[model samples]
Target: MTTLPTSTQKKLGLVIDLDTCVGCHACVVSCKGWNTENYGAPLSDQDPYGAAPSGTFLNRVHSYEVQPDHGQAALVHFPKSCLHCEDAPCVTVCPTGASYKRVEDGIVLVNESDCIGCGLCAWACPYGAREMDAEEKVMKKCTLCVDRIYNENLPEVDRVPACVRTCPAGARHFGDFADPDSNVSVLTAERGGIELMPEQGTKPVNRYLPPRARDRTEDVDILAPFLDPIAAEPQGFMGWLDKALTAMPGGR
Candidate 1:
């Protein structure tokens, strides 16, 4: 079993806002595109065009319809990926020591070369973040776009996870949680960000901002204005039409 570092220099992770996400799946597509083209082995799809298609993806979006106590039902889009937990079970569960957490940034990663596709990591992850690559026969999960973030050649603005960069709704944020002044840190505090399955004792670095309460429609009359006429005496084409209608059979 692999051991976790006592502490990390930086806690780098994602902050997702459930209210802002639109369930477009743009982040999922971008993650697949970027990881396949640049990072490690290409993600494989089995009979992609066929009826039963399956593929490897590090990121995914799930939609759920939630009913509030006094308001209407709302649809929430939740994006899931590796949380890079401080006490990651997947890391310690690996018999080959292929899974490890970096002390520098607290990013849990699997050394693919040493992986035997034992599926231990997948089983250990409570969030269902890990998956077995169909073609490579190895485990795959979100690396937080490590190559992109640290690449000196890329623009400073582009130095974030693929999902964060491609999120059209700006729902995903990437930053160092260790820094109190970081955007993710401030957002978490302000929005009351929550951990996924806190009872699991994983101490996940990633946080999720809950959706705000929506306006209730029970007391609102949307067509109230239309029901009442704006003018007591109609004029122009509308006036002519009203007069004609009134003149017709039982048209008062």
Candidate 2:
């Protein structure tokens, strides 16, 4: 079994804001695009043109409808990837020395060259972080864009993971969680960020920001606050359009 370092130099990972995420899947698309071409292993597609298309993607998003204790039912957009746990089960379960955790940056990575594609690592991961690439005959996962983050050829600002870089709603932040002053750590403290499944004892580095409270007292009309056909005009096209819209269900 692989043993983790007693203390890592830095816990570098992502902090995602569930409240700000719009379920747009921009992070998903961007992650697939960049990582499929440039990272450790090319995320392969198996029978892409077939009726059932499946590919090796590092990031995924799932939407869920949930009713919080005090708030109305809301659809939550959840983005999932490798959390890179301190005591990663995938690393300990690897028969080959392919899976390992870096003591310097605290990033868990799989060496494709050493992987045998036995599927033990994937089965060990409770978070569903590992995926086997049939084409490469190896397991692949999110490496935090390790190549890009440390590449001196790229600009300083362009070093973040593809998912963090392309999020339109500013929902994703990347930084060192070990540093209390880092943006990720500050955001985690301020937003009450939570680990996904603490009972598993993985000690995942990535954290998720819970949904912010919604104002139930503030009554917000869905579609009627701006309709005023009578005040605009009786004969104009604007008046006619407004009247037509107001007649629809919940429009007024």
The lDDT values for all models are 0.93, 0.90
For residues 1-252, could you state the per-residue lDDT of candidate 2 as single tens digits? 266677799999999999999999998898889888886778889899999999988889999999877657999999999998988889988888889999999999988888889999899999999899989989999999998799889889888988998999999999999999999999999999999889999999999999987756667676775664555356678778889999999998
Give the per-residue Cα lDDT of candidate 1 at 158. Answer: 92
Best by TM-score: 1
Which pairs of residues collide in candidate 1? none
| Best of the candidates, lDDT | 1
Error at 70, model 2, angstroms = 5.8
Q: Residue 124 of model 1: what lDDT?
A: 89
Candidate 2 residues lying further than 4 Å off, grouped into runs, are 69-71, 218-252
Per-residue lDDT for 183-236 in model 1, tens only?
999999999999999999999999999998775456778889789967799999
Residue 250 in candidate 2, Cα distance off native in Å? 36
Number of backbone-clashing residue pairs for each candidate, in the order shown: 0, 0
| Stretches of model 1 off by over 4 angstroms after superposition | 216-218, 225-252
Q: Cα deviation of 2 in candidate 2 (Å)? A: 2.8
- lDDT for model 1 comes to 0.93
